[model samples]
Target: MKILIAIDGSKASGLAVKSAIGLAKAMGKPPTLVLMHADVPLMRRVAAELGTEGTRRYHQENHDHAMKSARTALKRAKLAFSEKLVVDDAGPAIAKAAKGGKFDLVVMGSHGRTALASALLGSVAAKVLSQSTVPVLIVR
Candidate 1:
């Protein structure tokens, strides 16, 4: 079995990681786990202001920051896993990775925005659930 978990450096995502651990244990084998962090693109003006190298650094920093806690937790659990940092919107990126990587499942944490807020700002979880070919497990 293969699982891809989205990490956004939040407590909710940490819960998702814990759920992933339990799920893997229940499967009776150590499944392949992949930690993915999606980098929201910077505004055009900001990117231009940062220049090429600076922009690269910005994304790299963001990736590191987002992956930090998730990585620590996985390591603490004695789980072997790989990680990826993709520069794209979270919803599309996760759905694409789940399909492209041939993962059996995609797990992510949701802030559980109110209906109005979700409608206005759009829900990443909803988008992923709609677009993903694989099943998605959302932890609140």
Candidate 2:
């Protein structure tokens, strides 16, 4: 099975990575894994202030920080995976990557928002569940 794991350097996402590792081990096959981080676009003013090289460095640092936990977990588990960084909204970016990669499943962490809060602030997991063509496993 091919799996796409969305990570944001959070405790919840660490759990999700662990779960995916377990799932892969239980499957008795080394499933293909992709660790993805979505980078939010910088404001025009901020971009201008930072310049091209500085902006690139900033985004690279963010990606490294976001993927740190996931990378460590995967390495500790002796799992081989690829990484992708997208500059877009999290939910849509995840969904698009899942679809484009033709992955069997997408695993991600949830913030466990209440219905009202989800409705008001929008949940990434909820959006991925609604928008992704592939199945999504949300680890809380």
Best by TM-score: 2
**Per-residue alpha-carbon lDDT of model 1 for 63-118, expressed as tens digits?**
88988888888898888899999989999999999999999999899998999999
What are the Cα lDDT values of the candidates?
0.92, 0.93
Identify the runs in model 1 with alpha carbons over 4 angstroms from their true place: none
lDDT per residue (tens digit) for residues 1-140 in model 2? 99999988888888899999999888877999999999998999999999999999998899999999889888998999999999889999999999999999999999888999999999889989999999999998
Worst 10 residues of 2 by lDDT: 7-16
Question: All candidates' TM-scores?
Answer: 0.95, 0.96
The true-versus-predicted C-alpha distance at residue 40 of model 1, in Å, is 0.8
